[model samples]
Target: MAIEIENKDQQHPRAKKDGEVVERLLQESANDNNLAEVARLRIRYGGFPGARSMQRNLDIVLERWNLTEEGLFELTRQIHAEGRAYKRNSNGEEQEDWT
Candidate 1:
């Protein structure tokens, strides 16, 4: 006998809630380069089993942002090549990590 699983498209309630937050954060990051980096990190490393909503959010961002996984990785490569990272000053502004 063959069995089929149902509700495969359903997302967990918590995941759905988190996805909304993720979408909002991504939208806010558009005008903030520093925040963009943080958002990218969240998208890249926040994977877990049964995180359907979060994954869907990431897919939407990638499509809407017109960015590919390889492009994102290349951006990271350039940042590392420059030996700098986004830092914040005491005044809460983005600064370069010179050290």
Candidate 2:
């Protein structure tokens, strides 16, 4: 005899979308040469279930990396641009719009 199990609560569609976004961001972070920024990204979203976790993580990463908030913002901006170029070419818009 065999038993079967199932999840009681399925993830919402928005949660799934959020997970995809996080995965993409992590993938971008993983490719960077900057270890400190990678650590910051992990701390920001690596399944830490705590109150004010993001704030605490930001503080730690900034101090450890000696980076100002603007530096962090710039780092994230570069990371976010890594894979977004494809979106410009294949956004389901009219072909004429791409020319």
Q: What is the C-alpha RMSD of each candidate to the true structure, in Å?
A: 6.8, 12.4
TM-scores of the candidates in the order shown: 0.48, 0.32
Kindly list the per-residue Cα lDDT of model 2 for residues 1-99, writing each as its tens digit.
Answer: 888986354433334443444444444433343433334444444454432334454456456667666676676567556732222337774221111
Number of residue pairs clashing in candidate 1, backbone atoms closer than 3 angstroms, sequence gap of 3 or more or interchain: 0
CA displacement after TM-score superposition, residue 4 of candidate 2 (Å):
53
Whole-model lDDT, model 1: 0.55
Give the Å shift of residue 97 in candidate 2: 30
Say which candidate scores most in TM-score.
1
Query: What TM-score quantifies how close candidate 1 is to the native fold?
Result: 0.48
Error of 1 at 95 (Å): 11
Give lDDT tens digits, candidate 1, residues 1-99: 899866445444455445565767557533234334534544543555466656666666666667676765566566656755565789987663211
